[model samples]
Target: MKILVIVPAFNEEEGLVKVAEQFHGINDVDVLIINDCSKDATSEVGRKLGFNVIDLPCNLGIGGAVQTGYKYAYDNGYDIAIQVDGDGQHNPAYIKDLIKPIKEGRADLVIGSRYLKKEGFQSTFLRRVGINYFSNLIYLLQKKRITDPTSGFRACNRRVIELFSARYPNDYPEPESIVYLLRNNYKTEEVPVVMNERFGGESSINSFKSIYYMIKVTLAIVIDNMRKIGLT
Candidate 1:
């Protein structure tokens, strides 16, 4: 299978090399770095490492950056597309575990979750609270449980690649996108994977913005669910 690893980076020059090193000597997998108009040398760093790089004209946030990678995968005829954040929190070593279910035709989307084993960097207490809130919200809407709805470390088959490429959220999208797929009857699964603190750069979401994130994402998911039922 032709697998493409999509790393969406924004001002992550310091951690790009370390992230790339993890993929070294891995045969038959291509990595694409989506530089989301970073102010730093993210694009240059990606090219210097010999990875395919796409530099957007403007910052599109995480959701848009990831959607750009999905579009590239769709156009390039990649069979599987994996999303590993450029922040370096996600471990590329567990990539095999992520794509396994897809290869076996058991799942359309597989999310690498940190809560499954209660291992790795579990994030801040406030962030964990937000994650739990979304988990319950999604379950209430879909009757399905997604332990880590905010996890960006995930893999998808061509079907999901097509879905996301055509229509994706603009901001704070992970939770809403999962619900969108579930409403459409796509199979989603989670596999336990250890994560780490950011290798470099600061997170875009801070304590102050967490509140906005919660409100925006909650509304987006609810509206998406309503749309799926023709209530919007």
Candidate 2:
């Protein structure tokens, strides 16, 4: 199967080379860096290093960046697409493990989760609380238990690629997209994976942003669920 590793980068010049180097020698898997209008030299670095990169004209947030990659994957006839964050938090070592279920045709999407085996760098205290809140919220809404609803590290098959390319949520998307898949009857599974601390660059979401993220995502999921039930 044709596999595409979509790395969404935003001001991640510090870790670009390291990220690129890790994906090297993975045969038959092409790596595409979606440079989301980074203010730094992210695009230039990718080009200078000879990596396939797509430079968005403007900042489109993580969802838009990822959707762009999906569009590329769909248009290029790729069968599987995997997202590896450019912040250097996602390890390339588990790429095969994340893609295994989808490759076997047993799953439509696979989420690389940190809570499955309780192994890896679980985030800060408040972040864990937020993750727990969303976990309970998803279970309450869909009865599906997602240990890591906010994880960006994931792999999806062609169907999901086409759907996401056509229409994907913007802004904070990790949690809401899971609801989208579940509502659409797609099989989403999670596998235990290790997360490394950010190798470079700061996270976009800080304390205030996390609060805003919680409120925004909660409302989005509610409205989406309502729409699914013809309530809106």
Q: Which candidate is the best by lDDT?
A: 1
Best by TM-score: 1
Candidate 1 lDDT, tens digit per residue, 40-119? 99999999988899999999999899999999999999999999989788888899999999999999999999999989
Query: lDDT for every model?
Result: 0.93, 0.90
Q: What global local distance difference test value does model 1 have?
A: 0.93
User: How do the residues 1-232 of candidate 2 rate in per-residue lDDT, one tens digit apiece?
Assistant: 9999899999999888778777777677888999999999999998887779999999999999999999999999999999988978889899889999998988999999999988879988888999999999999999999999988899999999999999888877889999988987999999999997787877777899899999999999999989878999
Q: Report, for all candidates in order, the number of backbone clashes.
A: 0, 0
List runs of model 2 lying over 4 Å from the truth: none
TM-score of each: 0.97, 0.96
Q: Which ranges of candidate 1 are over 4 A from the true structure? A: none
Error of 1 at 51 (Å): 1.2
